[model samples]
Target: MQETPFCLTFGHILPYSMSDSNTTDFTNPSTFILLGIPGLEKAHVWISIPFCAMYAIAVLGNFTILFIVMIEKSLHGPMYYFLCMLAVTDLVLSTSILPKMLSIFWFNSREINFSACLTQMYFIHCFSGMESGIFLAMALDRYVAICDPLRHSTILTNSVVCKIGLAVVLRGSILVLPFPFLVRRWPYCRTNIIPHSFCEHMAVVKLACSDIRVSSYYSLSVAFCLISLDVFFITVSYIQILRAIFSLRRRDARLKTFGTCGSHLCVILAFYIPILFSFLTHRFGQNVALHFHVLMANAYLLVPPMINPIIYGVRTKQIRDKLLRLFTDKGT
Candidate 1:
């Protein structure tokens, strides 16, 4: 939607008047333009190649993990159930961004309606919080298996796992549900170009014409509080697990115990470090390049989905052997 420029004669000089019918009003809906990776116009084509590849791998890998876990009776335990949930979250998170991203990158289709933009923002943030919750749940599962091996089964029964899953969903939904409603109430009278690949909370809020103090403060508080709590619990769980491992007399016992948690640790580090860096850079680093911030935000979304399954497949022998056997059977 291009604006038509015109000039009006006043007293001494003629003033420029531009007609922008698409510009939003306080009473009506408007569309937003998503500018994917500012200052990278020349590299959009090259950048999208790797993004497409990673998205494909994430979809294939996570679905493979889900299928294997569902079909294998041995993998029907609590740990694997948590893994399945993680895969589902990764799939949802990846799908929420990639299709729109590819459309923007490849087709230059960047105009999104207001309601649609808010929906994307809501789900992306919601699923991200859910992933953090799932990580905490996985941490607890490992802690129980390692620190209280005798009661692991009793503590994490099917009913308990279902409850944990429901709690994760509710925690994420309750915290993130207010964001879209807040944004909807804001009158966006300025330019609606969001300088990011997706509809991020801050990026969208920055487009508002009204005061956004509450939106900013509340969103920041919710994010930090949730992430801090999850990380705190995960840290405590790992600390106790390490203590339990150290108490074992045999080296083999200690090695085997730590091995069970290695894949999860790899995933946690991969997921959290980039996310924390992205958020910190966006909120605090005034001198950071726009392209760098955009890249990090995207990595925070895409990298974990692409790498989690690979980590589990490579490190967990049960998954590895099952995958190999499945491939072998398909060939035969």
Candidate 2:
């Protein structure tokens, strides 16, 4: 419910405190206090339960992927290498937010210090950028495998694959690490109340007392460079893949190509679509389009990790058989 400003009366003849005219102070407070849980403060318990459950599932799913990929020697190929890297990134991504988010949802005192906010923001960007790079690696791997099947082994050497993985991690970290520094230099108005569950870069930046133009530009630059490069590279890889598949005489080869690429395409759409939606909504729509934005936020993080294992488990016979045996035998 909306609350009215307080009023005072002196024997039915009241005067507004001239100092209550301090609207400027309220607007430019030293700290932006978050008055959280607007309508359903009483429903916090119910909210907490589901939030905890979802987060638990996210953690477990990603962790399980990492475990299975590591344990099975048959899965030590390039595809599963990328898959495991992605699982690692997924775990980091979810962990960066979920524990703190769970804390806020379950209990009160949702105060996050400036340092903590910056830490969370930095890691979130780092892991996300890494995911993008790994996706590009995956695309490149598929491209080489499909388009150059004669010498796929020689071209995509284990050493070469190791270098590719290293470069992806390094480049991603380099691209995103500067963002936190740019943000930290600003003299924030001490508003700790993040509009979202975690300290999103733009949301936190928007709360700065100083002009965020430079920071915003940096953010936009990173997004444009990483995402555009990822999309362009993926598209180029897939186009070549298509050409290669068409050159084949057998119909099954085309079906095989479609099956392999289709899953990657689905995962790509799952990630980038929600991310782009969030970027646009947060930047342009203000508070108006937030419901969808929030949904997208959850989708971007959870869906990839949740669906990825299923994809591999269903499609890759060895993984399916291994999972079955592992579950059935529970090694004594």
Best by lDDT: 1
lDDT tens digits, residues 1-332, model 2?
32111111011221112233322323333332222232344565676576566567656766776788789887778887887888788778877877776665576556676677778888888888888898899999889888887788798888988999999899878988887787777654323344456767876667666677887888889988888789899989988999888988999978877777766777787778878877777567645434355445656766666666566667666667877888889874
Candidate 1 wrong stretches, greater than 4 Å: 1-29
lDDT of 1 by residue, 295-319 (tens): 9999988999999999999999999
In candidate 1, the residue pairs with backbone N, CA or C atoms under 3 Å apart (3 or more residues apart, or in different chains) clash, namely none
Clashing residue pairs in candidate 2 are 32-191
Each prediction's whole-model lDDT (CA): 0.85, 0.69
lDDT score, candidate 2, position 8: 13
Displacement of the residue 111 alpha carbon in candidate 1, Å: 0.1
- Clashes (N, CA, C under 3 Å) per candidate: 0, 1
Positional deviation of residue 17's Cα in model 1 after best superposition, in angstroms: 16
The TM-score of candidate 2 is 0.83
Query: lDDT of candidate 2?
Result: 0.69
